[model samples]
Target chain A: MKSLEQYTRFIEEKIAGINLEEEPRKLYDPLRYFLSLGGKRMRPILTLISGELFQISNEESLSAALTIELFHNFSLIHDDIMDEAPVRRGKPTVHIKWNSSVAILSGDVLFVEGYQQLAKYTDKRLPILLKRFNETAIEVCQGQQLDMDFESRDDVTEEAYIEMIRLKTSVLLGCALEFGAILGNQSEETRNHLYHFGVSLGIAFQIQDDILDLYGDPELFGKQVGGDILSNKKTLLFLKAKAISEASKDARFGDLLQMAPTDSKIASAKKLFEEIDAKNASLETMNGYYSEAINSLDQLESKGLELGSLRELANFLITRKL
Target chain B: MKSLEQYTRFIEEKIAGINLEEEPRKLYDPLRYFLSLGGKRMRPILTLISGELFQISNEESLSAALTIELFHNFSLIHDDIMDEAPVRRGKPTVHIKWNSSVAILSGDVLFVEGYQQLAKYTDKRLPILLKRFNETAIEVCQGQQLDMDFESRDDVTEEAYIEMIRLKTSVLLGCALEFGAILGNQSEETRNHLYHFGVSLGIAFQIQDDILDLYGDPELFGKQVGGDILSNKKTLLFLKAKAISEASKDARFGDLLQMAPTDSKIASAKKLFEEIDAKNASLETMNGYYSEAINSLDQLESKGLELGSLRELANFLITRKL
Candidate 1:
């Protein structure tokens, strides 16, 4: 099996080969620019890794990986516009660099381009793959809608939040892995196992992200620490703190949240989080998901497949600072 | 072959059967609302008519027609947002009624729904249909980009304008017809002929729309009669007027265009259009495309197919004031 580094390298090379310099320069330039401003490339890498684990040919799986990456970028471009975001991955967003209209149209073309890549697959599994992709794509949009709806409401439940993150974020990871497994001709059971594994890991990864947003080293996180707190974002930590504070009849947490996002206010919010043991609770939830992910992987191990690389990758993902 | 009214009724029935009331009401409601606000339903009707002309099964062609119509509405929702359009078909646009974010995400879902509808086609023609759809979808975006780009520039050539409109407006009509033709198992030659026929008809239809934007009755048009003129949109008429005035070395047309778009200024622009013979030039060009469209139909007729309904539809399209 290829190492994770080999899969990452393969994805990078494939992305580099994608030419986005077509006509209507305005439409494609933003696409090229957004793709150039790279992310972790984690989703595509997951696809390649799953393909390798399933003994798929590299050429057979490359297009699926490319499709996953392109879809990810397309979602980001549109999401950035909706979020009114100015920067992404330490660079200006497409909507900021160009304009919203350009971003909207370019993002749309990117979506079609992703499907165009997917249309290259002509296997018997194509229908299932396309169906899963469409369902996942729609769920992602629903998740975003739910996320926006949550922003305006103060009573977002933890269950609802987890479901939202699963739909918004985790399902894509699951879909990517399942896509690779399908291409590799894996059995339905193995595909389902990998999908569950990816979803559990994705949920854990996002919770870890929330924890890192407030507690990780500033330089390592590569973003403004406490950004969620500043924006009054109802992240997992905030929800947990609210729940704990209400149970304990403590008003300090609520008071801290209501304050303007000054340094002192952020400091107070952090202190309140510590006082409420929100970090430990969050870690507990994260570890539960991590264990669930391993349990899914263990089901695959019972089928006699080596999972050493996947285990290491999962550890790396859960333990990463950024 | 079905008459135009029969085709229209079939399309309306198919649209009514489409279920858009699935979960996440915020996400899907706007889609339902947008689709409910009716337009000409011209593209999908063309799909059905093309299918009928080729003697394809109605069940086989209905999904493709629904996909075309859904895709059209999807583009309109997003385009309305980009154009900052407040209304469409005499109703508030999705973005205006709800918000841009809702409109953007719903539009994204609508596009996915179109593909989901396409995924129902399990035939040898599936890949080709998907490929053509993707290519057409990308071109539509490029066309919209070019249109927006033209808005900020003064040097757009007539050739560039024609290409832009072809990308923006004509290709989808061609694609709708070609999609139906492919599903009908038509010969490649016949499919290409139908596609070009639709393209030529589409171009002439758009040119007629531009003409009506200025000269048609407001009640019949169901929109502000002088909207394009008021917005200083460089429609075919505006471009033709510029070309004609430059050829005659007349400055009145340029002067009129530069004036504020008051009622008197619109009157003066209309008079200038008459003086420069821009109306006659536009009509002549429209007739040329109408002829080209008929010629393509003639090629289809050579395949021993009757062309009465198509001829009637073409005449109705070019002759309609709105």
Candidate 2:
């Protein structure tokens, strides 16, 4: 089986080959442009990795991989528009590059294209795959909605915040793995195990992202650290800090919230988070999910499906630097 | 076979029965509110009608019918947001009712819900049905893009406008019909005929809508007469008038465009459209599509499937009061 890196390169070539109708340049140009600003392509690669674990060839699983990637981009386009975000991956977002209308319609076309790609799978599992895909699509939208809703409300609980992140970020990763397993013709029970493996990894990865926003190595992380705190985003780290402050009556944490977003604010918030043990608490939770991910892999290994690649990938996610 | 009225009532009931996630009220509420502002359930009815012609029972075809309805509403919500349309069917548009983000995400969830409804089809035809749905969905986006593109350009030709409407408005009607036909186990040749029947009917219906905005019974139509003209919309009728004016260098028509949109301008524009035979020209085009629609129905009839209901529906669309 090809390594995860090889699968990612293969997926890159496949994405480069995607053809969209050229006439409505306004409708399709944004899609082409957005896809051109490539990210890690982690989600699609996961589909391939799961397929490898299930002994499905990359060719047989490529459609689902592409579908996941296309759907991911579609969500980003619409989500960016919703957030009124200006840039994605250091470039103008689709909405900013063209207009919101173009973003909405192009994102929509990309969504339909994802479904079209999935329809290429002419297997007995197509219906089940379609069913799971539709469910995950709706869940992702709900996740985005919950995330947005959390931003405006002060009543967002720690549990609710985790659920939002799960819906928003993690479910699609789980879905990618599940689709791969389904296409490999694995039993539903086996697919569920692999799916949980993905879900746990995604949750851990997201927590790491939250932690890194305040604690990442400046030279290595590439982005401005503490950007989340500066933006007042209700990330898991912030929620954890709030939970600890409320339990301990920590007035210093409340004062940190009142500070204007500045370099000093970032440094002070970082120090406060560490002192209240909020950072430590978040790290514990992240490790919990990380351990849960490994436990899922162990379950898969017990079933005699070799998971060396998936195991390495999980480890990379946990130990990832940037 | 159920009468069109009975089928409409059935669809109305099904629409009312739709359930969405309750926790994220922000996401699902807009969907519920938009669907509540009911219009003629024309598209879904076509799905059931096509099913009946192919001897697929209404009960069996309800899922496809509901799928079409949900998809139609999904497109409407997103299109309204794109157009910044303030109202739909005399109620606030989803964007206006909630906000653009809510509308975008809610519309997305509704689109996913449409696919879930479609997945209820357990037959071998599900894959083909999904393929057509995705194709039509993409075409609709392209059509909307072209329509928006036409809004800012002076170079939009009459031919391009028709193709835009065909993509934006006609293809889904065709798809709704085609989906039903496929579910009924019809041959590809037979389904194409039924699909073309819907397409031709949709095109003719849209042209009639253009004519009605200028000349419909104000009391019956329930909208201000010549609203399209006053709004400076480059509808088919205006495009036809422009084409005529360009050919003849009719200075009066050119002056009419520069005139402020008022009661006097509407009257003069209506008179000019008649005097220059633009209205007559559009009527001929409409009739051409109407005849094409009938010819498709005739082909379906030649296959020994009864076309009474579909034929009546087409005639109703062509000669309806409003």
Candidate 3:
């Protein structure tokens, strides 16, 4: 199996090969700029790694990987607009660099381009791949809607939040892995296992993101710490902290949660989070998902396929400090 | 061959059968509201009528027809947001009724739902159909971008305007017909001819729309006369009048064109348009396209298919007041 580094390198090269210099410079330029801003490229790498596990050729998997990456960027463009975000990856977002209308239209073009890439597949697997892709795409939109809906309501439950994240974030991961498995001609059972594995890992990844936002080293984390707190984001950490503070009748914790982001308020919030074991509780929940992911891999091992890279990658994702 | 009314009825029934009521009511509700507003449903009718031309069953073509309709509505939702217009089909647009964010996300889900409909076809035709759909979808976005671009510039030529309309409006018409032709198992020669036929007819239809916007009966037009004039929209008539007035140095025509739409300004602009024969020029251009479209149908007639309904439909579209 290829290393994660190799898969990432392969995916990057394929992404670079995508011709974004089409006419209507206004539309295509923003798309090119957005893609060039570069996230971790994690979703496409997962697709490649999963495809390699199923013995699918890197060449055959490139289009599917590109599809996932393009779709991810498309979501980012639209989500950034909806969020009224000005920056992404330390750079001006497409909507900021161009305008909202340009961002929206370019994002739409990017989506259609993703399907154009998917249409390159000629095997019998194409129909199922397209179907799963459509479902995943719809789920991602629904997830965004729920996330937006949650922002206006104060009574959001943990269960509702998890379901929102699953729909918004995790399903794309599952869909990526499933695309690879399908291309590799893996059994349906194995495909389901990989999908579940991706879902669990994705949940863990998101929770880790939540944890890191408030706790990670500033230099290593690549953004301002306590951003979620500043924005009053309803992440798992904040939700748990709120729940614990309310249950204990801790007025201090409640004050800290509602306080504006001064250094003291942020520090006090962190102290309270530690006091109530919110950090560890979040970590424990994350670890549970990690375990579930590993169990899924173990189930897939019965099929007699090597899963060394998958295991290694999952470990890296769950444990990464950055 | 089916009558246009039969095709329209069939498409309406199929559309009514589609269930959009599901979870995420915020997202789906706006879509339901938009679809219920009811445009002419012209594109899908063309698909069904073209399908009948090739002896394809209405049932077999239903999914494709639905795909075209859904895509059209999806484009409308997003375009309304981009245009920031308050009304569609004489009712509140999705963005106006709900919000831009809801409109944007719902439009996205609507696009994916269109693909979901496309994925229902599991035959050799699926790849080709998807390829055409993707291409047509991309072209639509590009066309919209050009339309938006034209809004900011005053030097847009008649040819450029024609190309813009082709991308924005004509290609979908072409795609709808080609989809029907493909499903009908027609020859490539026939498919190409039908696509061109749709394109030419689409251009004629748009020009006719421009004419009706200025001259049609108010009750039948269902819109305020001189709206394009009021908005300074650079339609074929406007561009042609500007060109004629500029070339002849007819300052009255130039003055009328630049004047804001009051009753006097609209009346004067109409008088200037008649003086410069802009109305006749536009109708002549429309007839040129109509002839090109009929010529395309003539090429298809070598295959011994009856095209009377297609001809009648084209005539009806060109002659319709609304």
Best by TM-score: 2
The CAPRI-style docking tier of model 3 reads high
The candidate, 1 or 2, that scores higher on DockQ is 2
Estimate, for each residue in B1-322, the C-alpha lDDT of model 1 and write its tens digit.
Answer: 6666777777777777787757788898998888777667889888877887878776778888887888888999999999999989889999989999999999999999998888898767777788888889988888898999999999998889989999999999999989878997888888899999999999999999998888888888766777788888999999999988898899987788778878887788777887778988988889999999999999999888877878988998998763
Task: Give me the TM-scores for chain A across all models, comma-separated.
Answer: 0.97, 0.98, 0.97
**Colliding pairs, model 1:** none
B1-322, model 3: which lDDT tens digit per residue?
A: 6666677777777777787757799999887788777767889888888898878877888899889999999999999999998989889998888888999999999999899999999888899899999999999998999999999898999999999999999999999999999997777888899999999999998998898888888789777788888778999999999899889888876677678778777777777788899999998999999999999999888779789888888888888763
| A176-265 per-residue lDDT for model 1 (tens digits) | 989878997889999999999999999999999998888888898877788888888888998999899899999988788779988787
For model 3, the stretches where C-alpha displacement exceeds 4 angstroms are: A1-3, B1-3
Which 10 residues in a row give candidate 2 chain A its minimum summed lDDT?
Answer: A1-10
Candidate 2 per-residue lDDT over residues B1-322, each given as its tens digit: 5677787888988888887778799988887888888788999999888888767888889889888899999999999988989989999898897888888899999999999998887568888899899989989988999999888898989899899999999999999999888988989999899899889999999999999999788887778899998877888899999999889988987798788989998999889999999999999999999999999988888888888888788887899574
Q: What's model 2's overall lDDT?
A: 0.89
Fold similarity of candidate 3's chain A to the true chain A, as a TM-score? 0.97
DockQ of candidate 2 is 0.85
Q: Comparing 1 and 3 by DockQ, which wins?
A: 3
Candidate 1 stretches with Cα past 4 Å from truth are A1-3
First chain of candidate 2, TM-score = 0.98
